[model samples]
Target: MSHKRSFVRRTAAVVAAGAAAFVLAACGGDGNGDGSAGHGGHNATASPSASASASQGQHNAADVAFAKGMIPHHRQAVEMAGLAPGRAQSAEVKKLAADIKKAQDPEIRTLSGWLTSWGEEVPAEGAMDHSVHGMGGMMTDEEMTELENASGKAFDTAFMELMIKHHEGAVEMAKTEQADGAHGPATKLAGEIITSQSAEIERMNELLGKD
Candidate 1:
């Protein structure tokens, strides 16, 4: 009887945990009000396609590639940005984080608009293989593990380093899309990512050097 009770308790605990996870995910992320995540966490946003695909104007293979490639790419950027306020050490780091969130959130809304207009599913949730797009600066599983385990200043430093590289990779990919992509709105956003992230990279480098 005791063994059976123990099993029941464990099952109940697991169910509760899962329910909590779902709630947190639905709340957009379990970040602090300051807009930063603690260690390692995924973020969810309203589907960019949910509202804007119908008005996407014209599109082709390149447009599709830009959207497909960029959904995961942008997802990572939002993740990194969301990680900034809590994990970074310097004020500059926090500002960059704020800038990233501010910049990307609306862009997310805009992309959703594009997706809605195009009638494509917003490509937010997926196990995207970075190699398919030739992006190499992505976080390794182990690196992500370390970031998850880190705290305080260590968290800040590591987060900054990883995010800087992440932003650089994004800039490269965005430039490629800007030059070669077919979607009007997406390509415009790609250009913006290149310009914005490039400037941010310079800022991050200066912060890191101080660190």
Candidate 2:
């Protein structure tokens, strides 16, 4: 009977040791963070999809319209900004272009994402007739062409002159968004643009000494 009891004790000890080994092997050395394997790589790493999910916004129909409209608006501003680096001489005018490009470029991406998530077409990419989109200010093709053809100190002066007009137009468009835009993000961006460009217009006027 003593020998029989000893055999049972040995079997129990072996079983407990095996179970502990199995747990340790499954748990990776110290996946105390999670029950993943000791390899540490078994834990779920964050993906771009996860990051994007966190940043994704809940856009309204107004937001969709705003993105649709504002994308073209921002694109035009970027195109306008491009002229200064090549044609203008004033540090002030160049800075204005830089500011517009920096601000609007990211905003464009944001708007694009909103549109994509909504399963909508990117608005400005349409065969858009800008005449219908003329919310407030836009230079005629003739004026833009003339600006493009200019050179020297004249280029700087003309660029500033053109941008002030451009900025005024943007202010008007922003106001329209504040009044009529559907989405909060787009409306908010419109308000921001109005505030920023209005200030820029004032600064440019000081630099150019416009009456």
Candidate 3:
């Protein structure tokens, strides 16, 4: 009876050990599964954020050129527009100048911001003095001075003419950006510039009786 009881006790111990081992194996399997699932979830969350950042930050040489060139170009347009409030005689010319100033000032800020984010140099406040000569349709120092000196109808006519030329240059630059730039926001802005300035050019031509 003693030997039989001892064998029974031994058998029970073996069974208990087996049950514990099975439980441990099951727990280990669950832990590994949860860990892998957690890792996958983390990656899923990170991917879209990374992609969005990359998309926004993407830029090329043409985008840099567009921002750098447009900043000073916009500044010149704003400066030209500034002269109209005091010098222009026609209400329509004054309104056009005001609209030009309002539009281009924000664009200058935006272009500067792009340059800053891209780790490129923002054009200086005085850059138009030297930079204007290289860009298309930019008025010379002499021409700006002449516009500054003139008032009344002569100022109106001159403003319309010069601004028309300036808008043409901007349109050309924007078209180039549309064709070559890789930055999304910059390209979108280039499109907007093309549309708005093209319309303004038509209006200016009409104002000058050239259309």
Model 1 lDDT tens row, 16-84:
999998898867663453254322221223344433454344666566666666666666667766766
Candidate 3 RMSD computed on C-alpha atoms after optimal superposition onto the true structure = 5.0
Q: Per-residue lDDT for 94-159 in model 2, tens only?
A: 888899899989988988987887899986553236553445455666766887888657877777
Look at candidate 3 and tell me the lDDT of residue 143.
90
> With candidate 3 superimposed using the best TM-score fit, by how many Å does residue 87's alpha carbon deviate from the native?
0.7
TM-score of 1: 0.63
For model 2, the local distance difference test gives: 0.73
Candidate 3 per-residue C-alpha lDDT over 1-211 given as tens digits, one digit per residue, 9 for 90 to 100? 9999999999999999999999999999888777766667666777888887786559888999989888878888899999999999889999998999899899988999888988999988878766567586888889999999999999999999998999999999999999999899999999999999999999998989942
The global C-alpha lDDT for each of the candidates, from Candidate 1 onward, is 0.71, 0.73, 0.89
Score candidate 3 by lDDT. 0.89
RMSD of each: 27.9, 10.4, 5.0
Look at candidate 3 and tell me the lDDT of residue 155.
94
All candidates' TM-scores?
A: 0.63, 0.62, 0.73
lDDT of model 2, residue 55:
46
Whole-structure CA lDDT of model 1: 0.71
